[model samples]
Target: MKSSLTTIAKHPSISLLKSCTTMKELKQIHAQLVVKGILNHPHLQGQFVATIALHNPTNLNYANQILHHQCHHPTLFTLNSMIRAYSKSTTPHKSFHFYSKILHFNNLSPDHYTFNFLVRTCAQLHVHVTGVSVHCALIKHGFEHDPHVQTGLIFMYAELGCLNSCHGVFEGVVEPDLVSRTAMLHAYAKCGDIEFARKMFDEMPQRDFIAWNAMITGYAQCGRSRDALSMFHLMQMAGVKINEVSMVLVLTACTHLGALDQGRWAHAYVERYKLRMTVTLGTALIDMYAKCGSIDKAMEVFWGMKEKNVYTWSSAIGGLAMNGLGEESLDLFNSMKQDGVKPNEVTFISVLKGCSVVGLVEEGRKHFHSMRTLYGIDPQLEHYGLMVDMYGRAARLEEALIFINSMPIKPHVGAWSALLHACRMHKNKELGELALEKIVELEDKNDGAYVLLSNIYADYMNWEKVSSLRQTMKAKGVKKLPGCSVIEVDGEVHEFFVGDKSHPRYDEIELKLEEIFRCLRLSGYVANTSPVLFDIEEEEKEDALGKHSEKVAVAFGLITLKGVPIRVVMNLRICWDCHNVAKMISKIYDTEIIIRDRSRFHHFKKGDCSCKGYW
Candidate 1:
């Protein structure tokens, strides 16, 4: 025991052995030394107990023995070690108590490392007051100029959402290094202040890939996809090579832009650049292709990746489900389980989406229950909403209502919206009224909910209720959101809205759509013209229904894309008449049409919709 203590005192890396990072190995060594009667050595004992406390399964009894039996005032190294150990302990409050005791111990001075550790501990515990106090102390102790201390301060204030304090710390540093600057940039970006983050990036003498990534990510998060892509182009122009982090951000931009051409360019760029096969970058690529309306391309990328993780499967499954391949998604989930890839919360979200699409009531119920039973994951509110939506879509209104009523948390507008849509489908006025009441309570400004309820009343031929609802909407000044759709052709996005004649080619577009409708009428495509919100003559109603936003967009896509398969993406649900017309358009034009509506994907191929007359 005495010889080991002497050996440790002379060794510089002895503390490394005591670090929690090496706890398991250290425990084995401790066992060996204990057999040789070395656990009683005072110096080694303090170090050993401190190491154990820092690690999991803290050894409090052994820690107390060394604190009491050791010298009257422990060494600075010993005190710092104990402080770090306690800070990471289950009782973090005890860490500050130990810090207070450090001042009482003579011959010990807290170093920069000690302050940095204290700041990180405060951040982890979310003790903002204590963290601020530590920041003031660092300045008082003339340690504010230290780069490591400044970096820690920036991270702490950022975590607390105190951007002003973070900026002050960044400016006060004697000479900010790259690490400190990067931390400051990240601080601003994370706090939702991307403008300030870009300012910092522009002011830097040189920007590393990390700094570039931070700004790109910030722009992507703020939904400025154009700016993010522009920055990517600027980085290349400035001779900064794109790496995995940069690629991920750019892929996210493509998803938002629906820039399939740009995404394909990026895919080719990745192969040319030969960035290492990282899971994160691969997952981002899969997600990008999926969202850009290329499910087959997404699957190709998913299968090509050698190292597939939970996120990889989740992304591919989510893409398949979103593309109306619900059964395929569930099959992939089962295969993932067989391959021993444990599904995460995100994976469950994809699975739930599949259930919602296919109306798989039993499978949905089983997976929802397994979230708690098999995986021990407590269901979140989002999961509850999805479950309710699944049951509602299946027309199992009783189960859906029971689930809604029994939610541990208050249901959101989405849950109630699901019930309202179900009510519209099943013509259940009682449930519809109940859902409308809840919807108003949840969101008074929900114009869509009001419109849906009014439509329901109209469907029931309840003219008085429909008129009353419209009067209320007008009195409250609640304006309904206009449904819109967009189609991209030849590098330009052409948008359309109901009864809109804003396009330069409106006359030609209208004639083309009418011509398509004639063919549809011949092919048994009856006009289900009930969705139009108007009180007008029969001829006007037909005209209004024929000029729906999606039809305009599809007509534009067909004229521009010619004989090629056209994909039109809408920001709202596709009305029944539009769905039927899309089918007939595909058959008459001998072209495939893919539409992504609010509910799910619809692939109209050769007079057949992939939804199988279900959705």
Candidate 2:
């Protein structure tokens, strides 16, 4: 029977004989081939090899063993199948080495699919040199013109941050396809060139869902939030069906722009499309509400979700921290731990911020230590800055300085600024000067640092140093960022600058502010004009403080909104005098005022800020 099987397997019709559609039929044929002992024959062996490799049958390892012992040298198709299997397998490198063996020993010419498998492995491993070597091999063998090969090459070069190389490869192809164009767009976006990405996207003649998603994600990631939303609108107008990823990007852009109306539209679109339940989309929704100053809405979205992950928890935690529900945020952190979801670095940062806001020094210290001992996550620079800010605000200047020295990474301007502010708070002029020196060394153009340092020197009557610092700033062309604040009243965002009269209603705002001051004075609010220049007359100092950006914002809130609490969001820290006035305004008007300053939310009601006057 074995001799007869060998003869029939070599009969040349064996390739046609083994072409069975179903695995059951294939196995029956295999049984017949075994009865005749033709499975070991070379010509018949290739048939078994091609069939099993492509069929995805059970007992594939056994089939592989049979082919390995029989052929000693496999055919091109046989090698290609094995290559693909290995490419899809966990051990791609081993499959790649096998293909090399096929090429070296039997001179088996690899096809398009073979190189595809090999290059994909290089991409997965992020082995740029290996990928380039494979590209050279393809060029040497004259297969570079294959579109599939070009696509793979584009992806490899892009991932390597070699956008120029990716463009070079794409240009070599005559009329590149959608996949290659999308790859170039992704390359540009990943390399932080959003303009070039948009150009590449525009040049493409045709686009699929993947291409659109790539471009949208690129825009979203490159801080082109408005552009991303505009593109989404255009895609919708073009009748392109929105996918989960597209929704995610646009929702994130809404979050960044603080576009509450657009965010609501996105939320409605998600419900309309029945995508509200998707984890990615749900997380984006939560983030959108949180960032749009609607923490209650964010919580609603969070609680509505049936599934949640670290990002979901982080978004809610960070949102609550931002909204000044510090106690609630900390409670959620505890709940997250109780649910067995390990806190990541970002989660810890949010909770730390909550601690900083509420002055939970002991809890903050415990979490800081637990970062490494419990979670095994080392604190990064931002975390360090937060800790320094925390300790500094708690009036632990020495401990703050000690922590600065103990940081694993060199202190950046942000960390130094934290300590500098702490020094000013505690009147540590010497340490403030030292921190300023480090800050200038790290970031010479830091206007805030210069201003803070100058103020510290002035506090101690170091007029000469202040003059020198001012002259240096003028020489270096370092312009200070003008203080600004935004107050939303009656569905309009009113922006104000320190001592600015740019608004068309500037006169009305001024008159109303004067009235507010008179009312405050009548209610026992005294102006602390020390933060303003003493060189100015006493009345002028009062006038300047009244025209400070935050004061204008609060004044507008009081005059424009009727019978409601006002929320004022400022981009800078509230000065001591301004904070005092806010407390007084809230008390006299009998209205709540929520001020989100540079650091945290200060909810003022009846002559009290959430910080307890410590910040």
Candidate 3:
């Protein structure tokens, strides 16, 4: 039997292990090694563990069982293989158990490879303390200077939100290579230090797709969408390889700016280059289109996707809700469940928002309750807020208050803000004041709540209260956010603030707006000045209403984009006066106007709105 084992070890079944395509073949070889009495051979044992650990469809459980129970003594190579595999696995925290085992074995010591995988595992775990301990181990082992290990440290620190530590690790490198530098770039970008990221990116003698992606994603996430798009264009001009990450980041930028023309160009570029439409890219496209007020195009993308995940379904459902197609959103949510995609927390938020948008009060209640009871998802603050908004939008103010009072957790400012909005809409000064009180207790600088309550007072002709509210806002140093609108024309995004005249062609836009309102008046359109919070002269109030950001953007769109739908994205809700004007303009000019505000989309066509005047 010893002679037979020697012969098998000399010949070795390592080749067979390497060629394994499935777990069954691997198990057969493992059993053969056992029968041949060479399974405990150090070299053969390492090979067997590696094969199982690095299999195409890895069987970590089998490898783990063999390491813990079957193999009486495992080599450092065998344990490192297991650690590397577990580091990349879903249960990365399990890698620590193997690291503990490595520490116990005085005969074996961790190498740079071990530290690399262990640092990555710490990153995956997102446990800062564990990551610091691994860093210390790497330093103690004198492998901290390894470029790969340093890169891993950078990533781990970045993931743990220890940006200063990331910088320290990066600075420790004598002459960082491109990989290490790129890792540092990613660290800075991930930590929201885009300035440092860009500096690193520009200083690099050579830049790869990963570096470019980190920079672009940083810009997109930091609300610098214009800069993100600009970086993408520069990336193309620099002749860099564009991949799925590039497309997704650019789509996010387009979504933020409501740059549909550019977004459409991105979609065309994806098809023109034949880049595989991954689920993430597909979801980003849906989000961009839906947010840019092209819901039909969003639905088209949704239907064309061959694969759908929970996020994809949620994006589509939320898109429908944003476009004010509430019933369709609910139907799609049901279909998502039917397709076996369990709804996550975000899915329920979209579902509830859909209910609130269309005033599906009972349906919203059912879904909200189902979150905790049926799906085991605890009702988060956003869900509770959506329920309050739904009831409030339906004019069930008493029920909304009751629901807020009955929350299992402390009521957030969102719930109170929703009730305050409903009070402003219904001109309920008493409840609006009550909601304002609650909101002030939570967030003293909640400008929206104060604005809504002030509007309510104005609606009731309580000019003295409105003045007092304004004085209070001043005393509290709370200023209302200026309304801003973005419009895309000829692939360039133009922004407008309330009463802005910053555009070079502001004169032309103003002239065009004058012509539009002239035609609108002829068509019996009168400015509804009730939304003006300040008690000013009626004529001055009308003037203020006309200079709203959306009107300026729409006027510019009409000037530049003839015969195309004028899509406007705003930072605030559309006032009743603006909604009426948009409807009249759609009829008078025979045009389609789509306005996406902070709340929902208003699709105005032929003297009607898709919202049916519900919002």
Candidate 4:
């Protein structure tokens, strides 16, 4: 609108931008520049575009107005600004439409920065075929060699799980920066190839925090929890400052190992440094504490969070269910719904688990049926298993059979395994055999199925069938998985097996166990030897029951650690004898003992278990 643009020629760009603290101030300055006949000045216009696109923290609509409405003939800087804004925005359609403007309205060819922004937008949208077209545009414009552009392309392809294409783009980089190489590392890890990811990681001459985080998280995704913890320690020892991201991954490792002590240390580190507790890091802490036998602490972290995403609610709710707080878990689910958090399949899975723990048959049935009707979430195999387990645990084998037959999908191995466990609990050979038959029909003949069937027969005094099942297992080369338990003490994990006597303080632990046994006998702790049901003497049966892996792990914890909670991770379900003994140990020692067995969690406090003998 100005006739001669010279009134604002004395103003410096830096000071002018420094004056804009709000969008109103910025708009006023723009109007003054235009009325003063300096708005079209190249340097001032470029600064305005940059300020609108990158600097203006309040609103981005000003950029669009300046380029589309104010300037009939906008410069290259103006187009790039608008494009960059749209690229970072969540809704990217406007960004692409603006990119099309360059070909239609503007005669200016797209520069490397322009295409770089477009590539980043494509990555954010995760539109693969469209991204490939954008890549073709970059090639057509001869900006393919641009490092930032190629890096964007690499990330887009990597996110699409297209590792082969990532390899081509990565190999083409004449000199790769840390971002590009980390993208490649993450790409390999995404495909579950830890070895190749490590090879690429080791080849890097310099690794940043992002690079190290990629390695730790890759190991976790691959189910290498021990290796992930090892890498985190190495990263710390190498003098790389750990961030919240690394802390989350390490906490996840602790969750896998049931390493309560290590998880506590990570929590302390977060507090000591006053690092920002992002949603991800907070969710990880909740999960870690919950799995580590500290459900109260998990709840503490959960309630303290100002923001709760689906992951946060799901982990906290699921933790309660797994720890045998069925009623509390259900209540929290209701709260999550009232908070407007949509219940996904994972959330329903936790809800179903809570229903199973509390024997809420009618509630479970209603929710399972409503999964597709109300939530549009089709019931997966795990849901079927939960229903079956619920019925079976409630001593309703007939309903379990009916549910399995009604499943839209096939009742896979997990579902049948749940039914088998229920039959074992009720000592029902008829239904146990039926479930075992279905289990054998599946592709993976879970050895646990054979063992469960055998245990069921042993409980019913059908020794002949038990012997026959074990013979068949040997003929098929199926072996029962050895039961093992691990306990963490002072940042070190000690593993114990059934009848383990290999600890360095074996004599001392044995002596302590004897003393505890004497005290247990005085307190009328009658060992129920029904689980060791073999053609053995009473003495041998009692001995076998006493030497269970869970008991050994607890004894080790009591011997080494003092006055703190004892947490143990077991590879097999705790037998009834060990469960009873654990309750007595809790009451006798005046200490809490938490055990995570193959099935679910048992938090024993003052002779009372969280499961309440339901599991």
Candidate 5:
């Protein structure tokens, strides 16, 4: 090794360094270089330090030791190598310490890479104080105009929530390139300024895939799912190919919109393009199909994957739970643990929900306790809400109230609603009133609470209180959310509001609905008009119950759909009358009727409901 060091000059030394894959091999070659005085070569030393520090990060300490003990004075290249490595190091504070050494010992000024790495580190750490100092130093060195340095500055300031400074740095650039513009787009999205992100995306001369995905994701992140889907269509029309990132964003939008057709199209694109399947894309696809009523397909994709992460299991489990397959969801969760995948918060959300759906009170209680005691995760509001709902649905009203009172965090509206609605179900007027009082204290204008209370009053023949509550609701302008249902027919969604005879085919729809009503009566089915909380005439009440949005959508589906199941998405909980009607219609038409309401999924088939009167 010593004889060979003399023949190995700088260029051959690089070749040796490239060939040396392990730290042990590099150390042996480095020892020979030191013995032959090769360590004094500036370029050779930089190459050696970079190999250990940058390429192989775990050996950064060894690289730092070599830089500290080097016999020759540190050159800019050598200093930058150490600084660059430390920038990405877990201990990024060490990068600043090395920079201080460069300034004090070698009198070498920091280069562009030094600032770039430090600024990114600051962004990662969210250390706004250090980021500001780095920005000041860049300005002092007159490198603020450097495209790469300015890009880092933009990212740092954006992450730090210093949008004004971020924009100032961006606008201050002489002529920003693609990297710079893309950073700005990501920054704007992070800052919750989707409008600004779209502006930047539109103004950019050359739109890359990153830019396209950033804009689409920005819209989705801001709850503008429609805009995100529209942007995706425009991207495809522009001949920009869709990748995994883009597909995930588009699927999210489709999930929010319940656009089953669009989701199917995205899945087809993935298969056609042979895109590499990642956990994120797989999870997104699973969630999309699950929300779109394609649980079978979601599971098919789930089982075909070779790799599974926590999110993968969570999506599959949650998808099953959402589709009213509670037992299957819990089974999949057990499978996840058997496969050595740890459950996350989202995983338990589905687990608890499955327990609630299937009335597994003991299992739900055990897992709820395990959340904190076993996994060391505190139960969040959503978890508590699910528990309250689980107990309420199980007719354990006392336990539900106890759970609400014992909540570490203040109970949300959904939790109270679950308890109050349960009170109504069990005819527990006292607890129902108590839950409504707390709800009113939390939010004064909650109309749902008033409606639930009125129903409770009406149930027990307390007409005086019901009337009083109705007057109060009118005085406070508490309007009930009008019930609406959407059914997708031939790739287009048709919506029907309660008592809405405004559809173009309203004549045909009404005629079919009447025919079905006659058939339902002939089957010895009676309309349960008990859900009409309002104190109206019996005939008017029956007519209103008959014209519910879901009933109309079902009638529409029977007339339009040939053999496929009728799937309806509703904006509110299914009323008792509507639920009964759906079961009867499913039997009468001899077809499956699936309705997803605000609370849970109801699959009516052959005069039986998946909810089993539990919902």
Candidate 6:
């Protein structure tokens, strides 16, 4: 018996099975094992099961059949292998079937590996009760203190949004190792407790790439783009090996800040390190370039990619729309269909947005109906809002109102807000007032509605109504969101707020602004201060408009960054006055000025805007 075991262990079939690259090779080895009558041996059976179940192109059903039918006395290792494989598979619930088998086997018992995989399966399932039951099973099986098991529990609870449970599991460890500590940090970060995550990160004796990534991704996901970029800078200074994950996170930060220079550096770094341009990384590059006001580069990246997914197509399409190339966006949507990529809900949003920007009312309606008829995708609230915006922007207020009243679902704030914006653009005070009334009824604290209505009133020189709305806002404690703009120079982001004077070079920036306005005035630029809600003198309104956040950031850019385009990212929509000023500045200075506002990108060059006043 011992000699037969030794022969089976050293069999040529076993060696071939270990290195087999394809299912055919594996089956050939399996046939040889059966031909030698060594397949019935428990050790050989376990090895065969492991190889088949754990292979990259795994045959779990076949391995399961062999284990249950061929191996009469399967070992715990064989059962655990099945459990671990199924844990990562799409059918994670199948892992519980093998766990039950382990419990049924009188001679075999589950160990740390079984529980670790089981905990991960629970996380994948995202069932809180099942995760708790698994935790109890881990304790009953005497693996509650195992570091790997504990780490899995932390992750499981984090996925279930049970932050306290994760903390409890971490605190129960006698002396947590690096893996457990990192898991806790990830839990905090994943649960949106970034402050605690950062504190824990700082207190750690050592930090790895995973910990750094968790922190940076947490910041990015939470809309703390500045902090995300700052952390990326620190990660570089610490000599941590940058990977594709790091690049993607930093690119997201750059996208939010419109930090084109930093985004360019990240793209160059990926090339310098020869990192494989994965579909996700390629998509991020396209999005960053698009949002940073570089549509041509975005297109270049989109075309250069060898592999493209639906998300990649959507990003490219959305980038074109955001850059105010609505016709090009619609053209690409057709190309996407030709490439056999079915559009999802997000794809339709971009399509409708493209229609809205270019006033393609007929095309927007055709695509909007196609979403349901062709793709079986129901129009969501955002789609409805876009339809309203399309008609509203085209000055078809009656059609927009008809569409809003026809919505199957209750109209949301976005629909009314779109109508209000259109009213403000066309100076339709009656419709603007009606939209504001509906918006206020839906959301009394919507500062944007109040601000928009005030602007519409100010447009008609209705000072009493504007002052009344302001008083109502003050009474209701609805404060307008202050405008903020960010610009990057020398790879560092500079943020400016409305009337901001905190920058060290504020005096220099002020002087530069004076010079810029002088040049702009010489070229027939005038401040259109009708949008200002304050009932102040014309000179005071002009001064207030001049102190807007984007102008300050642009002034700083002119003073510090010469021979490069001035890129500004605003937290709100660019006013008419600022937009005109940017166009004149671009031509007078013979430079480009790109501003990404709340809605879309405005590329100012040679006294013209890419949006052509559409946005």
- Name the runs in model 6 displaced over 4 angstroms: 1-130, 137-143, 369-379, 522-524
Report model 1's TM-score to 2 decimal places.
0.79
Per-residue CA lDDT of model 5 for 70-134, tens digit only, reads 74587777777777777777677787776776677646788787778778778877788888887
Number of colliding residue pairs in each model: 0, 0, 0, 1, 0, 0
Candidate 5 residue 364 Cα shift, in angstroms, is 2.0
The C-alpha stretches of model 5 lying farther than 4 A from their native spots are: 1-146, 149-166, 182-202, 495-511, 521-538, 542-547
Q: Quantify how close model 1 is to the true structure by its C-alpha RMSD in Å.
A: 5.5
Collision pairs in model 2: none
Tens-place lDDT per residue, model 2, 198-224, is 888888898877888888888888867
What clash pairs does model 4 have?
5-37
Model 1: how far is 402 from its true place, Å? Answer: 1.3
| lDDT (tens digit, per residue) of candidate 3 on 1-615 | 788556655655777777778778878888887887777888778878987887842589999988888788889889888889988897898888888888889888889989999998999999888899889888999997898899999999999989999989988999988888889888888898999899989999898898889889888888999999999999999999999889999999999898999999999999999998999999999999998888999999999999999899999999999888889999999999999888989999999989998889999988988988998999889998999899998999999999999998999999999999889877788999999999999999888888788778777777889888888888999988899999988998899999778899999988988898889888787777766766589889988999999999998888888899999999998888889989988988889999988888888999999988766
* Candidate 4 lDDT tens digits, 107-163: 677889888888778878877898889889889989989888878778878777788
Candidate 1 Cα lDDT to native: 0.79
Alpha carbon deviation, residue 181, candidate 2 (Å): 2.9
Native-to-model Cα distance after best TM-score fit, residue 50 in candidate 1, in Å: 13
Instruction: Name the 10 consecutive residues with the lowest summed lDDT in model 4.
Output: 1-10
Best prediction by TM-score: 3
* TM value for model 6: 0.83
Residue 590 lDDT in model 1? Answer: 86
Q: Estimate each model's TM-score.
A: 0.79, 0.72, 0.89, 0.77, 0.79, 0.83
lDDT of each: 0.79, 0.79, 0.89, 0.85, 0.84, 0.90
Could you tell which candidate, 3 or 6, scores higher by lDDT?
A: 6
